[model samples]
Target: MLFTSIKPMLVASGDEAFDDDDYLFEPKWDGGRILLHKQGERIEAYTRDGQLVTAKFPELKEVAKSIKAYAVILDCEGIVLRGGRPVFDDFAYRGRISLSAKIKQAVLTHPAVFVAFDILLAEKECWNEPLSERKKRLSAIVDTSSSLMATMSVEGKGTILASLMKERNMEGIVAKRKNSKYIQDTVSPDWLKIKHDKTIDVMILGYREEPFSLIIGLNFRTVKNKPVGLVSDGFSQADKDLILSLSKELHTVKEVKTQWIRPELCCRIDYRDRTDTHQLRMTVFRGLLRDKRSEECVWES
Candidate 1:
C-alpha cells in the first residue's frame, strides 16, 4: 500500500506523566519522524511533513530486507544513536548534507536507524485497527536490528518509563491509548507527549514590544553575559505587565530593536533542550524569581 498520500499522526503535549491502564508508553526518540513504504524490493521513505527523504538517508534502503512482509507501510522515527542515547544534533546534521560523497561518508561514519512504532498496512489495511493490535503486527513483521528496529513500549507505566528515559537524556515518552485508532494528518488526543521537566534560571536582558518576547541571557562572573535565547511563551498578562513596568524603570539607551533592561532581574525558564548553537530550545518563562540575584544566575557548565 502507498502511504505517500498520507501523513503520520501527530501528538499533543501533556503536562506530566501518569499511570493509565488504557495507554501504552514508548520512548520519544530525538529524531526526525518518517514513514516507510515497502513494495517487494523497492523501499520509499517520507517525512511526517510529506517530504521524500529516501535519497538523503541511504542506510534506510536496507529496511525492506529486515521486514518479513512483502508489502507494508510503517511509521517510524529516524535517529542516530550514540552511547545508547540519541544525539539529536548529529542526526540533524546528517539531514543537511547535499553532496553525494559526503552523504555516503556520513552513512559509514554515522548511520541512521529507523525505529518502527506502528504499522499502517500489512497485506491489508491496518489503519482502522486498534493501536495495540497494530503494534503486535508491527513487532511480528519488523526485525530488530542496528538499522531497523521495532520500538519498545511499556504498558500502563508511563511514569516509570518517562523517568528512566529522562535520566538517560532521551527526548521523552509518548502515551498512546491502546484502543485508539490511527488518525492520519491530525493532532489526535489519543496520543500525548509527556516530556521531562527541565528548567534553568536566567537574567532578563531586554524585551521586544511588537511580538512581546523577552531577550534572556546567562550571567557569568569570568566572562561577559551570554545571549542564550529569546523566550515568548508561558507568560501571563500579569507577567507581561510586570516586565513592562520593570523595563520602563531599568530602560537603557543602548537599545537595538529590543528595549534594553538593566539585566538585574532574574527569572526561571522551562526548556526542552539546547540547540546545536547552545541556545535554549522551546523555552517557556515559568515566573520571575524574587529571591535569586541576577549575578547568581550564572552559567552552570
Candidate 2:
C-alpha cells in the first residue's frame, strides 16, 4: 500500500517565502529515484516505476539493516557521490543485468548512498504526516554514513545549494514547498526545479523509427575530427514533430545514416556528465536557438 509514482510538486517563491517554522527542505539529488519497500521484514527496493533494484546496490543494503519499521516504505533519492560530486558510473554498472565482478568492483569505487527525503510509513502509523514530520523520522534511520543522513537539508535557500550544484556541475535544484502535506494521490505546483542553461549543436545524420519514438543521430565533437559517441535522446515534442516533417526533406546519410539538417536551427540543451569527453549523460531539450550560426555551433575541442 505504498505510493509509487505520484505527480511531483513544486515550490514557488513568494514574499517572505519558505520563511515558516514548520517547513523543511533537502538538497535535491541528481540521481535515480528510489522507493524503498520494507513490508513485514520483506525488504526490497524499487525504482519509481516499481522496477526491482535492491541487490544492485549493496551499500543501500547496509542502510537497510538498520530499518526498525516493518511493513513500511520510504521515498528517497539514491545518489553516488565521490569527491563531492555525483558519480553516475555506479548506476550504469548496476543497470547491466548480468553484472560482472569488474563492474561490481567499480561500484565499490563509487559507493551509492541514499538520501531519504520522506517517509510514507511510520510504525503502523501513516507517515502521510506533513513534510516536516516525515523528514524527521527518515533522518533517524541508523547505520548509514551518507552525507544527508543527520538532518533536514539546509532550509529554504536554494541560492547557496544552487552554488554547490553549479560548482559540481550538478543537474539542478528541486524546491519543495514548506508545510506541503504528503499525499499519495495529488498533484500541485508545490515543487519547483531549476536547471543550468546549456546547449550545443549536433549533426542529425539519421533518424530511426519504431511503432512510435524517434531515434535521433548525434555526432560527437572530436579533437582530430572523428565522431566518437552517439546520442539519441534530448528531443522535445515540437522538435520531434518538426523532425518528422523534415525527414521528408533530408536524405539519410549512408555511412552514418544520421538525418542531416540544414545546421541552421540549433538547440539549447542542458545536460550533465562525468567525463571530459563532453558527452552528455543525461540531457533535456531547452529550445531551438535560431541565431547561433552553425560556424559558432562548434563545441570545446
Candidate 3:
C-alpha cells in the first residue's frame, strides 16, 4: 500500500505562555512542515500544502532506511540550521532550488534535518493514541542520532521555555496537551503555539489607497530591498495622520496611482513569521521609528 499524504494536526496561536502540568512544551522550529511515508523500499515526503517534495529532499530517503517498520508515517519539520539555530532562509533557499543536479548539490552543501514530533501511523494507525504514547512509539522507531531526530518536550515549563526562546531569538514554543489524540487537518486547542514578539524596523516604501495600508521593505546589504508586505492594523488615528503627512513630503510618481516614498522613513513592524514565499505573515504596523534610518533596516537572520 502507498500513502501520498497525511493531513497533520495544526496548532492554535496563543498570546502568552503559562504553566500547565497536563501539557508538554517543545521548541517551534522555523521551517517547513512535512510528512514522511515509508513502505518497503519506497519513500515519499509531502509538504503541509499536500505538495510532493520528495524529489527536492533526496537526503531524507536515508531516514526511511532507519525505520524498521513495514510502513510508517512520520510528522516532522524540515529545518536547516546555522550554528545550532533554525534558519528559515536556508530552508526557503533549498525549497526554491528545483533542478535535479542543483538539488543534489544543495543536499551536500545545505542539508536539512528532520525533527520528528509525532507518529501518525506505524505498523497501524496511531493517531487515536494519546500524545504521550505516540511519542514513545515514535522514539522507538526513529534513530535520533541521525539527521532525523526526535523533538524533546518539557512538562509544566511552557512559561519558562517561552521566555528562554525569546531571549535566544527563537521563533517560539508549542504547548501540547499530554493526553490529546492527534486530529488530522484540525485546528484544536490541544496544541497551542506561544510565539515571542519579533519586531523589525522596515522602510516605508509605498501605500495602498483603498485599504489604507503601508507597504514595508527591508534593506539587505547584498540583496536588493523589496516590498515584503503591507500593514494596515495596529496603528492609532494619530499615527495614521503622521504617516499621511510624511507620505506627502516623500511621495514620488514611480508607479501610477500608488504613492511611492523614499526609503528614508522607517517604522517598526511586529510579525509572527515569514510565509513560504518570503512575505511577512500576521504583520502589523506598530509605529514609526523616528530614530531609525532606512539603511539600518536590514533583516536579522
TM-score per model over all chains: 0.76, 0.60, 0.85
**lDDT (Cα, tens digit) per residue for candidate 3, span 132-251:** 999899989988645788888899889999988888888999999999999989998999988876888898988877668888998665665678888888988798888888888887
**Cα lDDT tens digits for candidate 1, 58-97:** 8766777899998899999888887888767567778888
- lDDT top scorer: 1
Off by over 4 Å in 2: 2-23, 39-42, 68-71, 100-103, 146-152, 185-187, 199-301
Local lDDT at 156 for model 1: 98
Better of 1 and 3 by lDDT: 1
For each candidate in turn, give its C-alpha RMSD to the true structure in angstroms: 5.6, 8.9, 3.1
lDDT of 2 at 87: 50
Worst 10 residues of 1 by lDDT: 218-227
Q: Candidate 3: where is the Cα deviation over 4 Å?
A: 207-213, 220-223, 231-247, 254-258, 281-293
For candidate 2, write residues 119-158 as lDDT tens digits.
7776655445666666667766533565234324667676
Q: How should the candidates be ordered by lDDT, best one leading?
A: 1, 3, 2
Cα deviation at 111, candidate 2, in Å, is 2.8
> Clashes in each model (backbone N, CA, C under 3 Å)?
0, 16, 0
Best by TM-score: 3
